[model samples]
Target: MESVKIQNRDMAWHIAANIQFPPNFDAAMTWATIIAVHPFGSCKEQTSGNVYGKALAEQGFVVIAYDASFQGESGGEPRWIEDPTQRVEDISHVIDYAVTLPYVDADRIGVIGICGGGGYVLNATLTEKRIKAVVAITPVNIGRLFREGFSNYDPLGALAAMAAQRTKEARGGELQVNELLPASPGAAKVAGLTERDVFEATDYYKTPRGQQPGGWTRMLFSHAQNTLGWDAFAFAEILMTQPMMVVIGQKVGAFGAYRDGMEIYGRSTASKDRQLVSLEDWSHYDLYDKPEPVDLALEKLAPFFKKHLNEATGQ
Candidate 1:
């Protein structure tokens, strides 16, 4: 794997990324490319690069896993903000950088988005025509998630609090942030959290199993300002014309990825071809780093990208 820096053209931010190559990779010959987008509050080094990026590269494709602007090593101010617009644009910026590499087959470029990254990548496909294929694993639409709080909690009240907090920040107060989960499963259980999504996510993000500085699983509270009014699949039926594969775990909980995946798969009426792969045993968090679940997702992803991208490039 090679460390690389991609420039987010619109914001002039330097996005940190890890580019992985197949064993005995040849720079003289162009190869299909894939950009892996990490989950919200997670960095490139987590499942994005360490899992999907490396796995995809070993399958004979060049994969680039990047930290979203403002979250990881990427350059941006007011750090930890999850601006959907900037996140969506980051995909194109990475593509722009990918095409400049000699060994990358720009025409055969594809993308895989994990968790919230899945939603961003799906949204990116609407305008970024260069993307030929997509894979959304346990996808979450932040907009919807924010608008409808977990398990029927009132979003209006939450949004109102955010507005009040922003007003305080505007008055020179410290910026407030939102932590997605407890520090550990033990902590979650003690807090009376019974949802599988809650404990599992805490285990994954807050523990050494997947913990890293960049994937701390926290975001600025005002992020809901952008997310509440946005919808990742807003116009996907019309503009999302690429081949897509939506993978989801059968365990549907408060996290809502299963619902999001099902909704997008149904709404993407314009996709040239789309497939929904559901795993019976795996929960949403299981797909993050678990070997069996990851392998299950890759089983569909590898051939999907290989077929669509190679077909598009006639390679």
Candidate 2:
């Protein structure tokens, strides 16, 4: 694995990425490339790069895991803004960089997106046809999340609040940011949060199990405006034509990744070969870093990517 910097094509930001090569990578021979997109509030070094990137490279593909432009080691101001439009474009910008590499087969590009990244991948594939295959692991549609509410809060009320906050900031008020979860599972329980996804996310992101510098789950309260009206699977039934694999855990929660996965699969009517795999015993966070669940997901992903990537080239 090696760290690389990719310039965003549509923006002024520089994206920080980690490129992982197969054990016996041969630059003389081009290989299928996979772009691994991390979850929201996550950087490349987390599950995307450290887990899936490394594992997929060992499975004989070139994989590059990257931090979103406004987050992680990437260069951007007012950091941690989760702009859905920019996030979707980041995938294409990564493709622009990938195709320039001598070792990459431009026609055989694929992508695997975790959590929010999964939703971004779906949206990106709608227009970026260079992507031949896609994997959405525990996908979450941010727009739907904002619209439906995690804690069952009113979406319109929250939108009004964000509008007010943005106006306040414009008028020289303090910029507001919020922590995504409690300090730890213990603290979450103390706070009277009983949701399984909430506790699991806290365990993974707030503790040593998965916590890191750029994965702090901080969000700009006003910037959430980008997500309120956006839909990751918008027009997917008409535009989502690539082969896809949607993996989800049966344990649905406030995060609603399972619901998003199901909806994406059902809506991507144009995808000739879309598969949805549900791990009956797993939860959303389990697939993030758990060895067993991740292993099961890879078993499906490795072959799916291999076949589609190779077949795309008629090999």
Candidate 3:
């Protein structure tokens, strides 16, 4: 594993990334590479990204996981803002860096994304044909989440809140921030969050389990403005030509995300192949780091990438 800095075009920002090479890697050998995109409000070292990156590397794939722009170690101003367009572009920028590596096979690149990162992966693959395959675990469509509540309830209220926040931002008001997870376990219960959603996130991101100094639970309210009109599934029918896989927890409480995944799969007419795997016992966050669900997801991902990215035979 090596830590490297990649500069985006125009040199406006530097992306801090960790590239993991398989054991006994040789510079002269061309190897398939996988770029892992972290979830919302999380960094390269976040539990899910770290776990998946290492696991995929051990499976003989060179994997690179990096913090998105404006968050974690990546360079940007107005920290913690989650702009959908920039996030999608970040994946391509990472690919831009990966293709330059001596050992990377530029023709055989794949991508994996968890949580909100998954949706961005789908969006990026719409136009980035260099990505041969894509895997999304417990994906969330931020645009749909902004337009419709997590559970698709009280959409009017959600829209009104986003409008109010946008108006305030236009007036040069102080940036409002909101927590991605409950501040305390009790707060989750008060907000009607499921037990799995509450404890899993708090334990992984806010406690000693997998916490990192740069990991944050807060994001700028202005993110809603960018996500409000962005649909990750847009152009799926015509542009998502790569092989795609979606691994979702059946019991994921955020129904809007699950619905969005289904829509993406349904509309992806250009995919060479498409798959949707539902883990009956898993929840949204469980696939983030839990051994059982993560292992199960990897079971599917390893073969999917191997089949699609292997250069021996065109997939």
Cα RMSD for candidates in order: 1.5, 1.3, 2.6
CA error at residue 102 for candidate 1, angstroms = 1.8
Clashing residue pairs in candidate 1 (N, C-alpha, C atoms within 3 angstroms): none
Flag regions of model 1 displaced more than 4 Å: 150-152
Where does candidate 2 stray beyond 4 Å? none
lDDT tens digits, residue span 1-315, model 3 = 899989967549888899998987888988999999998778899754579999999998999999988888888877888889999988889999898888899999999998789999999999998999999888888778766664255656655776788788789987778777876566666777755655677767876666886789778775556677788888789999999999888775643446767788889888999998888887787788889999999899999999989945453
User: What count of clashes does model 1 give?
Assistant: 0
In what order do the candidates fall by lDDT, top score first? 2, 1, 3
Report the Cα lDDT for residue 30, model 1: 96
Candidate achieving the largest TM-score: 2
| TM-scores, one per candidate | 0.96, 0.97, 0.90
By summed lDDT, the worst window of 10 consecutive residues in model 3 runs over 150-159
Query: Which ten contiguous residues of candidate 1 have the minimum total lDDT?
Result: 149-158
Judging by lDDT, tell me the better candidate of 1 and 2: 2
In candidate 3, stretches whose alpha carbon ends up further than 4 angstroms from where it belongs are: 150-173, 190-192, 195-199, 312-315
Each prediction's whole-model lDDT (CA)? 0.88, 0.90, 0.83
Write the residue-wise lDDT of candidate 2 on 1-315 in tens digits: 788888755778799998999999989999999999999888888898889889999999999998897799988878789889989988999999999999999999999999999999988999999999999999999888878864256888888889999999999999898888898889999999768888888999998999888896988888888788899998998999999999999988789999999999999889978999999999999999999999999999999999999996675
C-alpha-based local distance difference test score of model 1: 0.88
